[model samples]
Target: MHPVCEVPAPGESLAEVGGVNVHAGPAIDGRDRRRLERLCRYVARPPVAQERLELTPERQRLVYRFKHAWRDGTHAVVLHPHDLIAHFDYRKSKLGMAGR
Candidate 1:
C-alpha cells in the first residue's frame, strides 16, 4: 500500500474521515482508497500532533511532527461499536451501499 499523503488543513471538512475528498467521492483509485480505509480506521477520534527533534546535540536541530488519533477514542469506538459493521455488510451485499 502507498503511504497516505498529508491532507491540507483547510480541506479538513471537505475530506471524509478516510481522507476521501468528498468531491472525488467513492470514485477514488485503489491506492487512495486503501489509504482512505487506513485513515478511516483511525478517525473515530480527533487527531493529535507529536513532536520529535533530531540532532547531534549540535548547532542545528530538525523537528518532525505527525498527527494521530488518541488511544482513548479508539478504545471507546471499539468498545461502544457502531452501525459501521452493518453498513459495511450492506455495502458488500446486493442492496449496494447507501451514501458515498
Candidate 2:
C-alpha cells in the first residue's frame, strides 16, 4: 500500500449491497467458465489503470477516475504528483522469465 493509498471498498461496483466490501469476493461457478473468468479478472486487475490517471493542465496534481462510480456518486480522485508515483507498481523479473 502506498503511504497515501486509500482504496475504497469495491462494494460500489461488485456487491449487491452498496458500500459493503469484504476481503474476498468469491466466484465458484463450475458450469460457467466465462462468468468465473470475469470474477477473477477484477481481483487480478492492477490497482491503477493508465487511462484512469492523468495530470492537471499545469501538471501539478494527478486526477484518477474509477471505472465505476461509488454508490455515493464519487467518480474520481485528486492527488499530489508525488503521491501518485509513491506507490506505483511495476514488475521486473530477476529470474529472466518475465518476457519469455
Candidate 3:
C-alpha cells in the first residue's frame, strides 16, 4: 500500500489534499476511490469510524481509520472527510480557533 498522509485539521482545508467545503460532497475522485478500495481489500472488514467532532457551528469532521496491504506489508491511514454541516444547530455562533 502507498504511504498515507496525515489528516488535515479544521480550518486548514486545501484542494490538493481533496479537502472541500463543509457542505460539499465527498472530495475523492475515481482514482481515490480505487486506492480506498484496494486498502479495504487488505483488511478483512470495512474501515472503522474513528470520530465525529464539531469544528464550527456549521461544520463537523468525520474520521475513518483503515489498514491497507501491499507487497511490502500492511500500513494504516486515517482519512479525514470533512465539510459536514450539521443543520440542527444553525443558530449557534461560530467558535474561535481554540474552541474546537
Q: Point to the candidate with the largest lDDT.
A: 2
Of 2 and 3, the candidate ranking higher by TM-score: 2
For model 3, which pairs clash? 1-70, 22-83
Q: Which regions of candidate 1 fall more than 4 Å away from where they truly are?
A: 1-80, 95-100
Can you list the residue pairs that collide in candidate 2?
A: none
> What lDDT is reached at residue 82 by model 3?
29
lDDT of 3 by residue, 1-100 (tens): 2213433665443332222123222345667878668655754552333242223334443432233465566343322342223321231222222223
Cα displacement (angstroms), candidate 1, residue 34, comes to 17
> Candidate 1: lDDT of 23?
33
lDDT of 2 by residue, 32-85 (tens): 988888887976898679789998899889899999999999999999977665
Estimate the TM-score of every prediction: 0.16, 0.40, 0.15
In Å, residue 30's CA in model 3 sits off its true spot by 37
Residue 31 local lDDT, model 3 = 73
- Residue 66 shift from truth in candidate 1, angstroms: 20
Best by TM-score: 2
